[model samples]
Target: MSLRTALIVLTVVSVTADTMILPFYPQFFAQAFDVHSQAHVGYYLAACCISVMLAFPVWAKIARRVHELPLWVITQTLAGLLGIACYFSQSLWQFWLLSQLMLCLKASYLMIYPYVLRLEERDKHLGMVGLFAVLMQLGGILGAVVGGALLEHYSARSLYLWMAASDGLQVLVCGYLMWRLRQGWQAPQSEQSTPTRGWTPHVIRLGLLAMVFYCAAFFIRPFFTPYWQSLNPDSALAAVSISGWLFSLPGWVALLGLWVNQKRPGSDDHAQVLLLAMLYGCVGLWLQASADSALLTIGRIIYAWALFQITVRLELWLFAHSEPQFYGQDFSKLHLMQNVGVILASMTVGHWVSAWGYASTFVVASVGLLLCALCLLWWRQSDSRNAQPSHS
Candidate 1:
């Protein structure tokens, strides 16, 4: 396969491996070791999130030192082994440790994102960003669906085997890409940058916004299946597979929104659009929290559309301001921040569900989105003022 094709395959497989167990984490914890505390599942997910988040920066740093494909050949191999180890883990703690290690190793796959950006011309980076975001959402949706199926039909432990196989596939793809690199194909390099220009206020602001925005977007995720099932306890339609599909409704809507945005004209004031999206997201969260009927599904569609808008627009702004040479580092920072949001949500929502109720998470999600919008408001005012002329 061509290098770009190989990289795309690797991205899909790696994302699948990373997220396959996410949809049914509650089930996985309850089934595998018979540790049935929902709080514990939250704590476990939080730890895995932290490991994966911290691990990406390390992988990015390593990619700078070692050639990436060889590094993936080593890390993905280890990651695959760890997945198998988790499959055989006998205790809760053992499984937790093994999965954490596996996640850290698998985090290396995220480096391919920046590598893809570097492969393209600077003008294409925004389009590539949109493509990768769609890929990630699709992978996540697929993983969730597969995870639900595995948990419902197969044992929860089967998730590890699938993850292992996916990682192994990534390793093979890495080898092919490495060989292609050796076939006298020189990778395009972005213009070299001075050290001082690495991270800017604009990038930093976007990272911060991404962290908060992601937290808001995903805060409603962990308890969703249970909540949906609870809402339709007696309905024959409330099967695990159906619940998984509704849970991924936001992703599907986001994909559609992405396609529509690409076909539309580009006259939008992105900052203003982002602000409107935040408002819509908050309203969606409110509707989801306030309703138990089909309004919940409507809320999901609205929330997903808003989420996609924030995502694509933020990326467009981020890459618009960043130098090409800093794509890896900057992308790492953004990815790390987004995971921080996920970690925050995962850490809190489980306990909230355990204590307050599932509705509590949606309530908090709305508040989180509102807070993020306020911050963006401040940022917009500050930028507008700074852009204006000043008498010296």
Candidate 2:
């Protein structure tokens, strides 16, 4: 198989493993460890996030000195072991240490994204990025649906066993990619010719924008299942499955949005779309906060469209402003920034769900979207002169 196809397949398998237990985290917490405190869950999640945020930079620095293939082979092997350790965790603290370590190892998987870019021409960057988004979204849908059903029949810790298997599969795929390279298989040479440089102001702005916007967009994810269950008390037995599917609701909408985005004529409207998408997301959040199931579905659809657009365009903006030599390093920084948003969202949502309530999260998330808009406006003005729009 070609390197591109292998990497894309790896992305799907890895994402599915990572997100399988996500939608039912609350259930996992209660069932696995018999822990019920929302605040404790947040702290644990924050620790996991911190591990991932800090670990990627370490791996990036290592990749600078080491070839990516060997580095990934070593780390992913360790990550698979950690997954097995998670399955055997006897206490919350045991699970915490094991999972945090696993998350840090798995964080290196993120480098695959920018690496894939190096093998493609510059003009197709947005298309490739969008394809990754849609593919990951599909993986998420399958993971959540399968995980929710698994919850009905299996122990929550079984998810870790499946995750370990996925890691093993990733390692085998990585080997295939390395082997093909040795066999004289050649992909398109990237067109980026910019001199290697350190971080620029525009790149920093992009990082900040991603941080704030990602936190805003993902704030409602952790507790969404429980919230949905509360609204639909009738779904007693199939609650896990239904809620899991709902958790992937955004992914479904992302498929549609990206399909239309690709089909539609390309324009230099990335800046306008970036701004408008956030505003549209805010409207969607407001509708979700209405506390009606139908409106919630509609709101989710709207939010998904906006979220995926921002996600694709942000990377488009990053690569357009960044240098090829520093793709891994710059992307690591961006990864860290996005994780900061996730950590913030996780902690704050834990509090909001405990103190304020689930619906309040939507209102606060919309406020975040507005804040992101303001940041985007600032970034756009500063970057208007130096960078050309990245459109086909």
Candidate 3:
């Protein structure tokens, strides 16, 4: 297979395995470990995010010394092994520690986006990014569905086994890609200076906005399993897993549809699409927090769609402005900031949910997203005005 094909496959499998854990999340934390409250799931999720966030910059530094392909090979292998560890976790703390190991592996793997972008034709980059985003969602949806089925027919332990198998397969794919690269394939080098170019104010600002949106959107996710359990005390783990699958569907739809259209558009179009998506994302947040049952599902779907679109557009927007050679480093910074936001929000949301209840927590997150939307809106307007041609 072509390198791009191999990379896409790896991306799909890695993402699918990661998401499979979502449905079993609340159940695993609350029931399996018999945690004291629903919100404790956030602490577990936060632990994982914190490890990944802390490790990203380290991975970025490592990439500077070595190459992307080798880094992924090592990290992906670690991730797969950790999945086996997750299978044997005996308590909440054990699960949390195992997550730390998983994050170590995941930190390097997430940077595959920038790596893949480097391999693609410049003209095809944005659309391919979108396509990749869609594939990610497809993997997530399928993971949830399959995870749900696994929970229905077997124990949660089985889910981890599948994750382990997926990660192991990914290791082989990474090895194949490296072998192909030996045959004259090389990543595009960044033209910008390493220090002054990456982590710029503009990049940081956009990344921060994206991260905030991610945090607000996913703050509640760590608790979803427990929330479902609370809502239906008699519900089987399968029902909870199905809900996770359903929640991921809209995201996949949005990704597949818009990603194909994201050719090399003008900066103005990029900004417009991103801003609109963030706005809709806020609306999605409100809908998720305010609705119930079927309506809640619809809200989640819209939120997923908006979130995925904004995320892809934002990545494209950053790539457009970046010096090509610095792609890996800058992209790593983006990943760092995104995970930091997620980590903080996940930790904080646990406390909030524990104190205020699920509905109220969602309301608070929705409000935060609305504010984020407003900030981005203003940022866009300011950029437009600044770019206007000066009169003599």
Candidate 4:
């Protein structure tokens, strides 16, 4: 296979492995260890996020020192092994710790983004980035569907085994890519200064906006399966299947967003697009907070569309603004900020849900998105004013 094809395939398999357990997380914890607390689920998810946040920067540093393909092969293999170990976890705590281990090892897959981008012309970055996002969403869709079915028909342990299998496939692919590139591959040169760059005002604002956006979006994630069960108590299998479909439906909309981005390949109105998306997302969150199941389904679809567009635009903005050589480190910093937001949501939403219920959590999440929209609007206005010359 060509290098591009290999990268794309690796992206699909790596994301599939990473997200395979998402739909069944709550169910797995409840079934395996009889741990039913939403707060506990939040804490576990937070732990996973924290592990990835810490591990990403480390992986970026290691990427600078190691050749990309070999490093990816090692990490993918180790992640697969750790995932298998997680399958045998006997307790909730054991599973949580093993999960963290898997995530830490798996974090190296993130380097693929910058690696692939470096291989292409700068103008192609947005299209390539959108393609990467679309492939990731496709992988997520497949993972959610397969994971839900496995959890419902088979055992929770099967999901871990499947995840491990996916990682193993990635290892083989990366190993092949490493061998194929051996002749022409050069290690990335060491930077004269530290990789970390000073945060510009625009970057700082974007980071804060991303933080709020993620926090709002993920507040309900850890408890989504349980919430679905609460709504449709008739059959566990049906609930799992429906939840998987609901999660996967967004990918279709994301594919549409990718098509649109292809037609208009620029960041002329990214701020406006982002603000509009947040508004739509907030409306979706409110609809979800309602008691009607139909409305909830519609809400999920709406939220997914907005999420797909927002993420694609945000990544384009990052690539457009940052230096090419620093893409890996810069993207890692953005990922870290986003995960910190998720961690904040995971830590607080659990208590909020435990107290006031899921609807209240949704309401708070909508409010958070509104605040993000306002921040973006203000930042844009300030930017426009700064761009204009003095009248004198």
Candidate 5:
């Protein structure tokens, strides 16, 4: 199989194994650790956010030096082992440590995207990126639905065991794919390409903008479940299940979007796509602030749409712009910024919810999204001007 196909398949496995237990994390931590307050859950989640935020950049830089294939092989193996350990974790501390290990493995998955990009024979970068996004979203959908049902009937620990099995499958797939690449790997054809260089002011500015974009988009995610529970504590499990299904719609929507792109090629104008997605996201958040159930459902759908579009574009753009050798580090920095958003969002969102209520919290998130959109618009215009025909 081609490297592109292999990467899409691995993305499915990676997302499935990683997201399988996410729906239950807030409740799981609260119940397992005997924590009562949402604020406490926020703090514990911030621990994860911080650890992953710190760890991915280090891992990315290391992968840039050591190569992604070896990193993938080692991390997946360790992750499967950690998954098993997580199943038997008796204390919250044990669970937390095990979770840290898993995040390391999970974060490494992004490296696979760049490796596949480096390996592809064609220049269909944007199309392949869309495919990767579709697979990831679909995998999350499947994992959440299956996982929620399993959580309904089985112990939460059992979910970890199942996830371990999934990771084991991932390791096998990754190993086989890497071996195949090595059999035919040729650097000569792509090597003539000059690497994009510099820690110059411009490069730094672009990287920082990418970081800010992710941070604003993802900061409040950890609190979504807790917020749902606050609305309906008695039906927390049911609410979670429903929310999982709700979230899955975005994946299906993304798959449809990709399919349409395949049928009728369109502009890969990353800037315009991202700007529109962000605008829609603001609308979604405003709708979410409404007390009406119908309005909330509408908001969820809108939120999913915007998120699916923005992430797909961002991932593709990052790979297209980055030098192959530094793909891992660049993507890792992107992931770190995303986590920073989560950490800050967790701390601030809860307090905002308490002070101004959920409606106000949504408003704040919407405003942040708008501000990010405006910044990206300016960046996009600047980039366009910089793209003027260079003297050949």
Candidate 6:
């Protein structure tokens, strides 16, 4: 396979592994550890998110010094090993420590974006980024379905083993790609430059946007399984399977959105797209907050469609604004902000769910989404005004 194909495949596999346990997290904690507290689940997830956030800049620094292929190979291997060890963890504390370490090593995959972008021409970046997004969504879909099946037919331990297996697959793929690239690959001239730019206004804006967007999106994640249980009230296995399918609904919707985007290409109205997405996102969150379970599915579909568009455009925006020479570090900084948003959401959403209830948290999340939309609109208008010619 070509390098691009390999990278895409690696991304799909890695993301699949990373997301497999997500839909069943609440169930896993409840069954395996007899822990049912949303707050504890949030704390555990927050630990992983914070670890990834801390590791992003460090990984970026290392990427600047080491070759991408070798770095990826080493990190993927270590992460896989750590994941396997995490599966054997006997206590929540032990699992948390190991999972945090695993994520820190796994965080190196963030560099893959800049690495892949470096391989393609500037004009192809958006298309490539969109392709990556589609693959990611597809991976999530597969992960959810398969993970649910595992949980139903086998055990939560089996799901962890599957996750470890995915990481192991990533390691093998990265190692092979490294060996192949070693034969003929040459570093780009831009790679030699010292990256000096740090936290430009554009970068800060993007970071702030990421922080808000993810904070809104992830607030409901840790409690989703429990929320589904409250709605469905089925047997454990049935609930796991049903919720998995429910989670996959968004992936299907996102795929449709991707198809729509493809049918009408060359429309670079990112601001407009983002505005529409956030509008839909707010509606979706509100629907989810409603007492009807059927509305929850509709809400997920709308939200997923919106999320798909926003993620593609956001990455494209970041790539367009970043300096080529500093792509790795710049992308890393973006990842840091995104993870910070997740960390904040995971840390605080539990308290909100614990106190006000899940429906109230969704209302707050909808408001947050609305704020992000308004902020983006303001930024776009300001940019347009600045670009106009001055009449003397």
The lDDT of each candidate is 0.78, 0.81, 0.71, 0.79, 0.70, 0.79
Tens digits of per-residue lDDT for model 1 on 225-319? 77888888889657876787887776788678767756864434778888898899888888787647588888878888887778888877777
Model 5 per-residue lDDT tens digits across residues 233-298: 676444765665554667877877788768876566777888898899899888877765568778
Task: Specify the highest-lDDT model's number.
Answer: 2
Clashing pairs in 6: none
Distance (Å) between predicted and true CA of 365, model 3? 3.4
Clashes of each: 0, 0, 3, 0, 0, 0
RMSD (CA, Å), candidate 5 to true, equals 4.2
| Model 4 per-residue lDDT tens digits across residues 255-281 | 987898789865657788889999999
Q: lDDT, candidate 2, residue 3?
A: 78
- How displaced is residue 350 in candidate 6, in Å? 2.1
What lDDT tens digits, residue by residue, belong to model 6 across residues 1-392? 99988888888888887878876777888877899976776777788788888988898776655777777767877777777787788898888888888889888887777888988898877677777778877887777767767877876756767777777788788778767766323344456455666888888888888889989887876666667777767556336667767756666776776677666674577678778989998999898887688788898788888788888887788888876778887888888898988888878887788688867877888898899999999999898788786632
- Give the per-residue Cα lDDT of candidate 3 at 327: 74
Candidate 3: tens digits of C-alpha lDDT, residues 206-284: 7888777777767766555456456656646338456565555666666556544653363446777777776776667
Candidate 1 vs candidate 5: which has greater lDDT?
1
Across residues 1-392, which tens digit of lDDT does each residue of candidate 2 receive? 77788888888888888989976677788988888877786777788789989999887766665656666777889999999999998987889889989999998888888878988988878788888889888988888777867877899889999899889988877777677676322222332333345667767787888888888877887777778888878756337767767677778887886777678744556778789999999999998887688898888888888888889888877887766667777888888899899888987887677788988888888999899898878767867754655531
Q: lDDT score, residue 238, model 6? A: 39
TM-score of each: 0.90, 0.88, 0.82, 0.89, 0.82, 0.88
Of the pair 2 and 6, which is ahead by lDDT? 2
Residue 188 displacement in candidate 1 (angstroms)? 8.4
Model 3, position 65, has a per-residue lDDT of 57
- Please estimate how well model 6 matches the true structure, expressed as its whole-model Cα lDDT: 0.79
Q: Which of the two, 1 or 6, has more TM-score?
A: 1
